[model samples]
Target: MELTVERGDLTTVAADAIVNAANSSLLGGGGVDGAIHAAAGPRLLAACRELRRTTLPDGLPVGDAVATPGFDLPAPWVIHTVGPNRHAGETDPGLLASCFARSLDVAADLRARTVAFPAVSAGVYGWAADDVARAAVAAVRSWDDENPAALDEVRFVLFNDVLLEAFDAALVAA
Candidate 1:
């Protein structure tokens, strides 16, 4: 897979799928999750609600991911994954790493050629930007290596120049 780092709003990306840094509820919350739900319109919420009523009755587990229709967003599919919250005492780096890997697994299963991702757990979840960058890059790269030709592209959509730079460096280091 080709890895690219770009500083922009993930909501506007036109990839095959976009990964949301979601709360376990998958209903909708702040940051990237809220922005995606807003851009994707009410139909997105309806899909999530259906998911809650069915497959994810107890809510999505941290580090795992599920796919839903993107509705109004440019992408056809939205993959939601809950990152472990450090403030809530779920501080395992492996869990954070799994968020990236598992999202790719879900995307590959959906036959997504391109997938966009936010810096999961780096915002209100209290993870340092650089640390999140390292974990994201490492996991994504590892997944690509383990499953060659499974995904055509993976974009890390960052919000600012600082995070963009950090992810770029992490990609290089990986």
Candidate 2:
């Protein structure tokens, strides 16, 4: 599989699937999650509510992932995962890594050829961009190694120069 880091909006990525850095509630909040909900339209929220009413009444736990239609967004699928909250003392790197690994697992199950991801937990969750980059690169590269050619491409769609540099540097270091 090919892995590339690009500076772009996650919602605009035309990959087969995009990962949402969502809150546990999955109802939609600020940053990437809110952007995704807005772009996907109200049907996305309705789907999330249905999920809550049925299988996910307790909310999605950090590091786990679930899929939903992309709705009005560019991609066909959205894999939502809750990132560990640093302020809440959930700073474990394993949890952060699980967010990447589980998202890939979900994408593979969906038979998606390409997937786009944001910097999970690096923003409002307050994880350091550099550390989050390292963990994300490690998790994705490890997954790629274990399941060669499982995905055609994996794009880390960074929002700005700093995030791009962090992920790019991690890829280089790998």
Candidate 3:
């Protein structure tokens, strides 16, 4: 598997699947979640609502992931993962790592070769960019080690230079 980091809008990044740093509700919220939902249009919300109404009546759990069709976006699929909120006392790095690993698992289930991810838990969620980067890269590397041929490329589509720098440093150090 190949790993890369690029500064760009996650919503516009071209990939077979994109990972949304979604809230537990899987409903539209701030940051990456809002952007992806907005880019994916109304169908995405409808799909999410259906998931909530049936499968996820309570809400998605932190560090867990689920997939939905990317209705109006470039990617055909959206893998939604709930990142742990630091403000809510969810400071476990393992939980943060699970977000990435589970998203990759979901992508592999969809048979997607290329996947794009945002800086999960970094924005508004209160995790530092460097911490998020390290946990993300480590999880992806560990996943790749286990599923060597499952994916072709995994791109960290960061929204800012700070995140790009953090992920790049993590990649180099890894």
In model 1, which range of ten residues has the least summed lDDT? Answer: 160-169
lDDT, model 1, position 114: 100
Error of 3 at 145 (Å): 0.4
Off by over 4 Å in 3: none
Could you tell me which residue pairs clash in candidate 3? none
Each model's lDDT comes to 0.95, 0.96, 0.96
What TM-score would candidate 1 get against the native?
0.98
lDDT of 1 by residue, 1-174 (tens): 789999999999999999999999999999999999999999999999999999999999999999999999999999999999999999999999999999999999999999999999998999988999999999998999999999999999999887898898898888
Q: Candidate 3, TM-score vs. the true structure?
A: 0.99
- As a whole number from 0 to 100, the lDDT of residue 118 in candidate 3 is 95
Cα-based TM-score, every candidate: 0.98, 0.99, 0.99
lDDT of 3 by residue, 15-81 (tens): 9999999998998999899999999999999999999999999999999999999999999999999
Which residue pairs collide, candidate 1?
none
How far out, in Å, is residue 109 in model 3? 0.6
Which residue segments of model 1 deviate by more than 4 Å? none
